[model samples]
Target: MHKTKISVDNIVDNQTFIPNYPIKMSIRDVDFFYGSQQALYNIHLDIIENQVTALIGPSGCGKSTFLRTLNRMNDTIPGTSLTGTIQLEGVDIYNDFSDTSMLRTKIGMVFQKSNPFPKSIFENVAYGLKVNGIKDKAIIAEAVEETLQKAYLWDEVKDKLDKSAFLLSGGQQQRLCIARALAIQPEVILMDEPASALDPISTSKIEDLIAELKKNYTIIIVTHNMQQAARVSDTTAFFYEGVIIETGDTKKIFTKPIKQKTEDYITGRFG
Candidate 1:
């Protein structure tokens, strides 16, 4: 294992972990709340460009809450509010765009369960393009094919493009949803326990797909599976009770966390 030159001396009081690359998104001192209850507290994280950043913790640790905050998905709920700055490429996403549709398109999301549309497989991939106002059928068809290929689901469903998306198996359906997300060509992808519902084989497939996707897209994934986070992420952040304890290179975070709290959680001491 390669140990980084970064030691306690360079970190934020030897707790906050930062990656060694240019940040695609910078989240600074963010706090989020639903009514009177606060779910996240002063989160400071950096997502590197064109790499997979994994968020791991026990349930209700605000990992998912933080993920939704990336694209402002939490705004859909009533009485939820956020304070602090979240910037993409130095531009404040919330302040820059009054209409979040463009933001949602720029940062796509995939959920824990496979939620394919009732429409045909082709239409599922084309939905984003259509909604974004691509009127040409040929363009949409080409995009669907390209996106399915990019999602690694083209071969399985190429012959069945006209069939309903619900006809696919659980794993295939998840990949279909990924294809849907990719159709719009998002710059960032946020996944919330994307493979938590699949079998081992299906989970392996998603893991491998995530590896391939990061070559082109910046990805931030929230996963309960420690092994999955270690397998696919370049950087990892450990969250507990709305606070980020550590964030660093995945190898370092898993193999040699600077914080005792992170070490205890990673070693199976307690969630």
Candidate 2:
């Protein structure tokens, strides 16, 4: 087994690093279960505000499961239970006083598949704002434009805002979904394999967007692509069989992993 050194700063490249942001979220001794089977171990991690943290591992390694716990997305699954502390800005998210719906508004999610509702492009992005009772049309329109531009989809679909979102290509649709998420102005965005279904060009575009997005929103992504994690994230955490083997800066995790298992997984020796 090849042993790799683990260091935290290797995850984010200094050239693209942002400065002076606070710690946005923290996960301490997190454990999860689906019915009677536990899916995650005693996981502890910190998500820096305005930076990207990538969760990388092979299939069924609990990366996705861990992502869902951050925003309480796991509550939807029947018989699912979580026992741990997930904090947002020093407040415990799992506490009884923590409102799940309000928590979700602060932490948005983008899925692997583009899941636009059966509505026009304009309506899709406006849904969240409307649900929150923002009745000013001008404000809504301005926000829609700003978010669309941020997602790099404004120029492509600017002329047909009334068109059905399903009419767009897979990549465009995915960007629209991102725009929808951005419309809510969530402080943190959890993405599970956001680029897994796209072509090389689309994947590259998403990666670039993620790099840019870290300046505004803290990001946590679950990805199987080691190269993608290394390229886009400030921090990288490796998972194996429901355990976090090692986590640190992306460079060290890729070039000098602290554990033999992490090195093997990253170097293609074995998953």
Candidate 3:
């Protein structure tokens, strides 16, 4: 796996590389279950502010499950329960926060497959803003344009704002979804394999957008692409069997992992 150098300076010691940023989200002793089956156990992770943290693991390893927990998306599923604290900016998401819609506004999500509503391109981006009760047409229009620009898609679709979102290509559709997520001005973005369904060019575009977006948003991504993880993330967490085996600077984790499983998985010895 190729390792990208991190922009932040870290004080490296024999044991760990200490990141400089404050923790945006803190997960301590987190456990998740679905219908009596435990999917995660004793999970602890610190997501740094304005950084990209990648979660990589094999299939059914609970990385996506853990992602959904951040925004309480799992609460929609029956027989699902989560124990332990997940705090965003020092506020316990489960205990202290009662407004799910508000919490989700601060933390937005993009899925593996691009899901665009059967609406016009402009409406798709403006949906969240409208739902949030922004009634001023000029304000909503500017926000939509700004969000599309942030998603690196304004120039492509500017002439066709009234067009159906389904008329766009697969890559354009995915970026439209991203623009939709960004419309709410979320502080953190959760992406579950955002580029997995796209071609190489589109995937590269997504990676580049991620690097730029981290300047303003804390990003957490669950991806099976090890190289993509190494390339885009400042920190990397290797999850095995629903547990994080090791997590640290992306460079260290890819070059010299502390765990045998991490090393083996990164080296493609096994999943």
In order of lDDT, best first, we have 3, 1, 2
Using Cα atoms with residue i matched to residue i, what is each candidate's TM-score against the true structure?
Answer: 0.93, 0.91, 0.94
* Selected candidate, larger TM-score, 2 vs 3: 3
lDDT of 2 by residue, 52-169 (tens): 9999988998999999999999998999998878899998988943578888889999999999999999999999899888999999999999999999999999999999999999
Q: List, residue by residue over 1-271, the lDDT tens digit for candidate 1.
A: 1122223233342223343567799998788889978888778888899989999988899999999999999989999999889999998987987889999999999999999989999999999999998999999999999999998899999999999999999999999999999999999999999999999998999999999999889999999999999999988999888888788889988998988989999998987
lDDT of each: 0.88, 0.86, 0.90
Leading candidate by lDDT: 3
Off by over 4 Å in 1: 1-20
> Model 1, residue 158: what's the lDDT?
93
Per-residue lDDT value at 197 in model 3: 96
Error of 1 at 119 (Å): 0.8
- Show where candidate 2 strays beyond 4 Å: 1-21
Q: Is candidate 1 or candidate 2 better by lDDT?
A: 1
TM-score attained by model 1: 0.93
